[model samples]
Target: MSRLYASLFYQKQVTEIFSDRSLLIYMTVVEVALAKAQASVGVIPQEAAQSIETICTAQIVEQLDMEALVMASEQAGNIAIAFVKQLTAIVKASDEKASRYVHWGATSQDILDTACILQCRDALDIIEAQLGNVHQTVLAQAQTHRNLIMIGRTWLQQALPITFGHKLARWASVCKRDLARIGQMKPRVLSVQLGGAVGSLASLGNHGSAVVSAFSRQLNLTAPVCTWHGERDRIVEMASVLALIVGNLGKMARDWSLMMQTEIGELQEPAGNGRGGSSTMPHKRNPVAAASVLAAASRVPVLMASLYQGMVQEHERSLGGWQAEWLSLPEIFQLCSGALERTLNVLDGMRVSPEMMQRNLECTHGLVMAEAVMMALAPKLGRLNAHHLVEDACKRAIKEQRHLKALIGEIEEVRQQFTATQLDDIFRPASYIGNIQEQIDAVLRQAVGAAD
Candidate 1:
């Protein structure tokens, strides 16, 4: 009724970035850049660029009649047409001659698409900062728990032993890869769109290419090989990357939620005065951050599919497909921002209990360490024979309610081959961790190398 995951965890920074004011500001940015770009090629006077730039602030755009603009947009089939008229009117009041060239050679799609790219670039900056924080938190977790032994579960059941740091290291590796993807895609996705009417630049004639190049330079964006009026792959690719990054966030949420369960109790979300609480149950400190992240993960795919669907534009310009991106991109960015913030909060406050981890490790009654005990005897008893012997011992140990090590000594073949010290060392969970630190180091090094 109120909001999913509640308004308590709502991220204001995300909401502000997609606000009506923000959108208008970016659209005005595109218009000012257009004027400045035209001036660079002698299409518009330099004084006009200066005049347009002076009044293009968000504060100025906020003063215009947005409701009237939206009402006017319905007849025009889009908002940018009415918005450009408002800009022209405002500029006319200040300097009449400059106002005539306000939206000179650009179509609505050019202004709208370029404005969307500007917003997206800013949104990615916020996302990148949050993601970096997550990377640092995960890396710290791995370094802190490098030797914290825990049970590794498969199919929701204990399967083997692993160091807690190893699990954290895996998440760190995922964050690093996600950052790399964002960096690679930003250049391609942040390019300006300046094809007029039908991706032809017909109005500007010989000066179109120069204006386009200048527009990109003025805005500090890349110049595309050609116009992308009907080509929607850039937005689609960006949506795909955002969806993938959120999927990784969902993975972390699922793992933390499971580990926080009473039966497992190996990990916990941060405890606070109004965080992760259940209204009726006093015993319930629900993993709300994880729930929020998981909710976002589940919801984003539908929006992403819409972006993908928007890719099917017809001819050099599309009627419906171009309209689809207006809302979907903002929604996706907002969802990712909320999810990223909650995830970072969860990581910052997360608590790992080695005591509980150790207790749970024994819940399997030494069955999880089977691989370790089995390996130690493999060389002595021959691989097949040793596996058979340990497998038989495991069954007996389970039935007799005794430890695996207790039963290993009773087996004649095992007793004949090894002494008490060998069994003692082999059965320890510490012995089974096996190069986890080295693996962690390698992952950290690889992430650092990729960054460099």
Candidate 2:
């Protein structure tokens, strides 16, 4: 929780949104909104609501002692208790009548939960924008490399040929799904939390529901059917979605790091400004962004799991479960936002070496094309017979250190089955990549539709 490495591991914008000062400001905004809502339903005097609003400005909230508030929170069981006390005192100095109505019927959970929702709204906006940037960058890469042939691996060994765009399109499709999830989750997670003590607004009499509606309207958040003092699905869902996004980013980073290996050299993270530098070696170009993303990906799921465990709260209000979220949720947002930002950077500046890809594709010396040759011969010989023949040729090709195609040319069955011209076409990398363009196009069309 120390901010020593915050700039390196968390997005600066998101970090500020979850800052201590921002939290105080959000809590103050909630109290102000509550006052105005109560007044709208005639639960409190309009003049009193006006005075509370006018007195509790950002400037006034800034004057409150944060260090004292933190110290008091340790003894008070939660920050909102101390925060409400300070806010009431501040309003008392300006107008005595307004002080009486400060945080009038609302409890600590209501204020704190509403403030957290407000924070999540802002944090989600940043994440959505970053995801959009990454999605667009991936689409561009897919479009640009649609036909750039490369070797596709299975179990880390060359299996067949595929276009690099096919790989990028898969990332694009996942990003589109992530965007859709963000859209679906906003309404549920952005709902205002307002319940007087113990999940019911018993103190507000008949005006409780009205105040809830008005408060939600004032904040531009959805009002739930009832209070969720003990229910924690919304918070958990937000963490789940964030974890899902981080997981996808980790997958991309893993592939990128693998491809950036010196033996592969098919791709590289962008170089400049002393990035990807080595501390001890002069010839190192590390996948720094990818590594950062992977670190976040590894860390966020465990944080998200804590939230899931926090879901089993006691009735009305939790003893320890509810408080667990205070520590887990913001950290989840911070790590997820960091991962999204790093992914965008990598996608934007990634270096794709079509030449190296082609070279690596051929490094196997037609061994990669064995499947294509086998399929071509499958019709002449029985399927099992063709598999055996190609299997034998593959071994001979490796032992003789010669191309599989040349070795296959010497086989009597292959000579009788096809001409040299046909065999030449069988080994072409592009020829073996099946329907990759159509797949990429389908992904791109879905991405465009999602944008619309």
- Point to the candidate with the largest TM-score: 2
Q: TM-scores of the models, in the given order?
A: 0.96, 0.98
Position 415, candidate 1: lDDT = 83
lDDT of 2 by residue, 1-452 (tens): 66677766798888888888999999999999999999999999999999998988877767798899999999999999999999899889888987899998888999999999999999999999999999999999999999999999889988899999999999999999999999999998898999988877989998999999999999999999999989999889988999999999999999999999999999999888888889899899999988888999889988887888988988899898889998889988999999888888888989999999999999999999998999999988988999999999999999999999899999999999889999899988889888889889899888878433
Each candidate: how many clashes?
0, 0
- The lDDT of each candidate is 0.86, 0.91
Residue pairs with clashing backbones, model 1: none
Judge candidate 2 at residue 325 and give its lDDT.
93
Tens digits of per-residue lDDT for model 1, 283-323: 88798889888887898898888888888989999978878
State the local distance difference test value for candidate 1: 0.86
